[model samples]
Target: MKHRDSKDEEKVYKINGSTSSMGNNRKKKKNMQRLGGTGLSLEAFANAKSMSNKYNPAFKKKQREFYKNAKYVSKYKQSLKQQSQQIDAFSAVRPIEDQNRTRDVDEKNIKNKNKKKPSMEELYKKKREEEEQARIEREASIQAKKVGREKAEAERKATRAKMFKKTKYGQPVMKYRIEHLLQTIQSSSRISVNNSN
Candidate 1:
């Protein structure tokens, strides 16, 4: 047979056994079967315990009262109030003594502190070095991109040549087209410098 008939195969079947639940919902099947035929309801069976094994619940009343008094809350509040008052009294006065310098003297002092500066020659050399490094990196990236493109083009041409080789068609037009494409690709792939004598 060339191929099997698709209609003879069975269709795929999917059964979802998972449940959308918060926790396990397993039920005791044996107990269910035993109680199912009896006349008692499930709720009656749950609440129907013997009197010999029962005891009183812990708390029967809903409302409750605490009897302990805490003394530390008022003490802490008073201490925090006194500390805030002390901080306010000290913040009005400056902590350090200021120097009595005139406006012109202050300006001269500022200028002296900022006197040191880089030379023009050093700045120029740093700028030139940065530019040279950037140019070198740019050239390297361009060369890498050119190499990648060349590799990809070569692989494409090889695959096309292989595909045409396997075909046995003898039409003259198709043969010429294929040969021309392959030859043009090969010529382009060659690196020929025009500066030769």
Candidate 2:
């Protein structure tokens, strides 16, 4: 049984249950026949499109032409009409100030284009020099850190050995002198520990 759709076009739906996958496939075939046997998946359509493109590869040279053709050939006429009538917020032209700013930026870029360009050899030389400087700086820093750490370790061992050494004559005393600084430290036990009177 066939029925006319709201579009006045006759759409022959399966009078029986075609909800199952296999039944839906049969219905798809019937629908394809109704629409001139051109119901193809997007991938199949794209492949066919690419194959057709070989014949007239330059047909869509301008994207605007393609867009215009798309609107013209769109199935949703009412939607197309509404789109044409409505103001697209996204497509609004930039303000005058923004346009001027963009133009100024473009002019500055155009002017910059006139500047001399360094040759590949110069660029490579500059990069190599920079890398060499970075390497030298890194090595210097690492050596300085190593030297600082070694000095600190040596100092610590010397100080610790002095502090932990057995007191000479049973007196815990350590003394040292820098250029103008004299330092002294003594570890004292209880008053009765090492005193006799």
Candidate 3:
């Protein structure tokens, strides 16, 4: 093998001995110098400026419109929330007003009777009586349901007893077995007569 210098190596890789890596690097340096050290060509800068000028105003306008619409939506939602809260407040006050009216009527009746105001103990006793009445009603409803269930069970047992019979060996047998057998025999006879026809 022959020893080669760097110049010979460059010549071996050059395309048709006209272009080399050094030549390419020189061309790149020239291009960079022509671009004023900004690395961007003048044509690229012009194209970018035109694109930004053409699209930026429209994009900003659309952004403003979007924000305006969002503002309106939020305001409408807040108003709706306020209205619902007002309606809730009104509804809540209505029940309290009704309760106040009943209390006022009770106070008027007591005044008309020329009686002193009931003591706290008397109020507590009245509340307790109301609770006891409610408990008694609940228990009565439960007892009625229990009695209804027992009556239904008794009725079911009676129906079952009527539909079945106990043999001497104490085995329960269907009481309608003979009726079912007669029905099947009649049906078979009818079918046979029809076939004969």
Candidate 4:
């Protein structure tokens, strides 16, 4: 005897105390069976429930109310469209009137220009007024700056005076000279007393 299939010998098979010569491939067969006959009807189930609800009087009434609300919503949308068209037409006419009004105002201004030109005195007075206002602003700004500078200078001077008083070198330098003069006066007094004695 000779073994003809080494690959077939690698798999184990047992059925009723006897091994089948072929591979035990039942899993693939069962999956194919499941694909063929699960017996589920999703569409039919949904249709059955919908039919029952459709025959119910309360459900029919609710459906009518829904349809009525939908109709009103569509009517409202149509009215909004018509109102938008009217607004667009009104806006189209408004700009032309606004332009004509502006043109009339321009013509009045041009008519006024043919009258007497502004006097040189008036022009000079206007210029002088502008210059005076500018001068006043500059003077106020300069006054504020001067006040700040003076305050800073005063603070610096006070700090400097305080630092100078705290410094060791600011002590009296003539202390030893005064002590020497005192000793000389005492010695002269002793010599004068001895001479008098």
**Ten-residue stretch with the least lDDT total in model 2:** 178-187
Candidate 2 deviant stretches above 4 angstroms = 1-116, 167-197
TM-score for each model: 0.31, 0.34, 0.28, 0.30
Per-model clash counts, in order, read 0, 0, 0, 0
Q: Candidate 2 lDDT, tens digit per residue, 28-111? A: 899988889786799977887788746454775666688887877785787777787664443356577876887899999999
lDDT agreement of model 2 with the native: 0.70
TM-score pick, better of 1 and 3: 1
Q: Best to worst by lDDT, what's the order?
A: 3, 4, 2, 1
Best by lDDT: 3
RMSD of each predicted structure: 24.8, 16.8, 20.3, 25.7
- Residue-level lDDT of model 4, residues 1-197, one tens digit each, is 87657554544334245555443456656776989955448996667668874466687788899999999999999999999999888867787878799789999999998889989999999999999999999999999999999999997787555444533766744555465578779999999999999
Residue pairs in steric clash, candidate 4?
A: none
- For model 1, residues 1-197, the per-residue Cα lDDT tens digits are 56645333222111244432221323444556677844557776566533324532333121221111234666778899999999777754534332333456789989998998789999999999999999999999999999999999998897666555634465344664677788888776663433342
Where is model 1 poorest over a 10-residue stretch in terms of lDDT? 60-69
- Candidate 1: give the clashing pairs: none
TM-score of 4: 0.30
Clashing pairs in 3: none
